[model samples]
Target: MPLFVKDFSWEQTDKVVFITVPLKGVKASNVDIFSSEEYLKVSFPPYLFECFLYDTVEDTDSVAQVGNGTVVFKVLKKEPGKWPQLQSDVIDNKEAMKVKRTEAFAKAEEKLKEQSKLKAEQKRANEQYALKEIMKAEEEERNRIERVKQSERQKATEELEKWKEEQRLAAEKEKERLMEERRKEEAAEREARKEQEKILKRQTRGKKANIFEQNAEGAPKREVGKISVSFTHRQFPTPERESVKPKEEEWLKKQAEARRIVELEDENLSEEEKNPMWLRDKGNEFFKAGNLEAAINAYSHALRLNHTLHSCYSNRAACHLKMRNFFKCIEDCTRALELLVPPVPQNADSRVKCHVRKGTAFCQLEMYVEGLQDYEAALKIDPNNQQIKDDAEKIRHLIQTETVE
Candidate 1:
């Protein structure tokens, strides 16, 4: 039971029609406008305005502007001709106008559904295209990284071979120098022995000449001498020695404890296999064979026997990394690094491995900055490692890309 808006105005040209409706105090957001080839309707809560046009118009090309408490519509006519009136004569026939309104509303709803469907299809297509582009970019990046890795590995291998050749040559030179020095020393010793023999012969001849005089002097010097010897004073009749009794007892105690622990942990282990070094070797074999669980168990057993085994922790971290347990890998790497203290040449390689492994885990977790720091630390330890340098540079580029985005 909405009231009809009767004060609307309209004008027409040969090819177009203009309609303006006063919205009174109605807001634009509350207005609803719908149009078809022959009918147009505008609803604003209690007010409604509609028209069955005098002639067919192009609703597809129709446009509406709403502002300042008014709505303006510009509709195109199907035929380029003047109209006698804005609305048709059926406006006075309630039944006919009602039927027309229902038909027009249904046509407008169908058109809206088709447009919405088309828009959805277009949006879906765009998203799929974007996804494909992203995947392609990722694939290209992976290929580039693989190529770089292969090149670096080849270069490192060549450098290692050249270094080994240089070492072999230098060792040969050192060996020849040592052999020549030894020969010179042997010749000098032979000459000294010959000279000593000549001196001894000359001395013997002189002694023969002085034999009569010496016998006379010896006869005068036939006196005996007595020598007194004293032993070190001690309350106990035992030889003196530094006291190491307590140290020996402590070492024996630790050995006994280690044996007890090993026996209790695994009765199947033989006496030879109970050693920590044996267990570590077993772990290495298991790791090389790709038995990660067995390797981890072996490494764990070795660590239990000897907690200071940094190599066991480092190797276990490698296993964890292969298993994609990144957090566990980082933990093992950290533990290994802690055990590899003082930064000695003997432990330099182990330190570098731990740093690189931990960095890899960090990068897997998307903590690029932390990963970069660890890689840099590894590079400091092994400055000649081109692989680590390249990896660090890639991470830096990723960080930059993310930051820019």
Candidate 2:
């Protein structure tokens, strides 16, 4: 049904022409190719093709070569201009099919390239939009923080001004109080002078000679009330004291009743109220309430009264730990441990806690060896304590770490 090649390509240039044909599974010696101005032919095993050219050409200048499983033919054109068609005669609509398929493929490839470019552009646009949104959010956050900082600074400034005014008013009141005290003192001196004059007039009524005789005799003197003056910044609690609330008074009363059995003969001990144990309890309450300064004051007072009280030291150490006063915590814990010397079975828990507290402080201070030693001591005191065991293990691991950073 076919007299020409079914699988072949042909194109004509201004000065030359070309025809390509596949020769898969065929050797170069086994294939044959020939062409003319009006005719093209190819021969290989099991395949034969022959077709007529569109124009007449010189057949002598034609050449054929086979390489990479393809056979190529080059021929000189009879004229130096373009050719409208590859073949002079057509069969089975092959020419129309080839032209349509080539154009469709080229159009499809162009469309694909355009789609890829558009997708790339859209991706880049989305990325830019995301970056812009992130930057906007960050800028807004910075603005919000700046506004808050400004507000806080303004509030602080107003508070400082108010405190200064209060200080000024207090100073004025103190000056007025001192002036009133001076007036009262002058009035008292005047009253004393009037009494002395009345006494002298009574003596003069007796007799001028008798007054001089009584004065010379130096009569037994009667005791008069003495005036005492003292100055102090210390505040003593009374009914009119503003700092002493009713609840605090009640707590002091309760503490006093609790310590009623203890001897109150030690008059030198002084604190907020009552005994050293009461002060210790007060410090513990302050610690529970998160008042570090008040707790420290109460504990210091208790220690001043009785330096052997270990509970106050330990509790104060706990407060110091919360405040991140690492060295202070260690010092208090050490003192508590010292006061709990010769650890008995009943005091083992206290000793263990002190050691663990000191160890934790050491760890926070980056003293790994000291921390480990304290933890080990705690473990020795309470071998069954899992917490101490874990703490010691962790410290050992930390020490073994070449760099804690």
Candidate 3:
């Protein structure tokens, strides 16, 4: 049983009541205070104080200060008035006061629970709003990038059309120039041939009249001989048969059969089920539903269909991390990072996620040095991320502490 604190003094105004209680030698840290609409309690080890007020006071507006071997309360009154006495009607009844104290404690706990629930709801609402804003911003950014790409593509197409038109005009001009040059050459050749015929006619008129007349008659008597034509036979050189033909044919047949089986299996799947993107979306749904195994299976199927899908690897790595398969997490994160090649702005966030996930796996495996390197790499990609910076700082601190130990 605690000694009752009876030396406390209090004063009352029309709207407020001030109570001062001395610690008598107890430290301020050891004091505990509770207040309600009509009850007040101050407790320290070996000391206890209780008051059932004459009227209800505004507990929400009440304030208590503890320091310097004393506790003072500035309690607001519910109604502006002076009371007949500080204590309530049950001041001398110990059992009644005890019951009042218990009820007040229960009410305080209930109020605290209500406040906590309200705060949690508010926090969830705020987080949802923030997520919405982030998604909206990302969508707008993608739209802007697409519009810019469209504009650039249109400009390139126009430039290509212009280049083709220029080439066509140049080709036409070259054809016309070549044709004109050929016509000029042909006319020159005709004139040269006419000149040569005139020269021949002049020479023949002077000298060949007597000599060619007898020679033309004499040259007609010559014999015609027949010649036989024959073609050489052509044959293709065959390649050397290094292996047995029957066994090679059998191997080829087996390969074809295996290929047919694979095709048949693929044909059994629906178009949506066959799509890697669809499987990835399904995996995301499973992940949100907290079905890690289902999510991993979905991601694995998606990866099989499209091995280059970095998001699937990254998502599967997340599932592995949650399942505490740290080695698998590291492997998936590494594969995802490899697939996210060239490090463009579009894949920057994915790269950062992979690096951070791998870093987390490394840290979980107590490979702090490797984990720190990955975290630093992630920081380089997302320098403005305060959360990553804080995490890196924590890892560094942990490493230092471990080293010292």
How would you encode candidate 3's per-residue C-alpha lDDT over 97-196 as one tens digit per residue?
A: 7888888989999999999999999999999999999999999999999998677556655654786799999999999999999999999989977887
Candidate 2 residue lDDT tens string, 1-405:
423356788777798888888875678788776554456667786777666666667766778788988888787887789988776544457886455445545655676798899999999999999999999999999999999867755665575478679999999999999999999999999999899878767755755444234334687434344577975543344434556566776887667654653544356655446567898988888888889989999998777667789988998898888876777899999999989978799999899888898999877766789889999999889999887788788889888884655
What total of clashing residue pairs does each candidate reach?
Answer: 0, 6, 0
For candidate 2, what is the lDDT? Answer: 0.77
State each model's CA lDDT, in order.
0.87, 0.77, 0.87
Model 1, 287-396: lDDT tens per residue? 99999999999988888777779999999999998886777899999999998888999989999999999999878766799999999999999999999999999999
Write down the TM-score for model 2: 0.35
The TM-score of candidate 1 is: 0.46
Q: Give each prediction's root-mean-square deviation over alpha carbons.
A: 16.5, 18.3, 24.1
Q: Candidate 2's error at 56, in angstroms?
A: 64
Tell me the deviation in Å of residue 19 in model 1.
0.7
Answer with 1 or 2, whichever has the higher lDDT.
1
Show where candidate 3 strays beyond 4 Å: 179-405
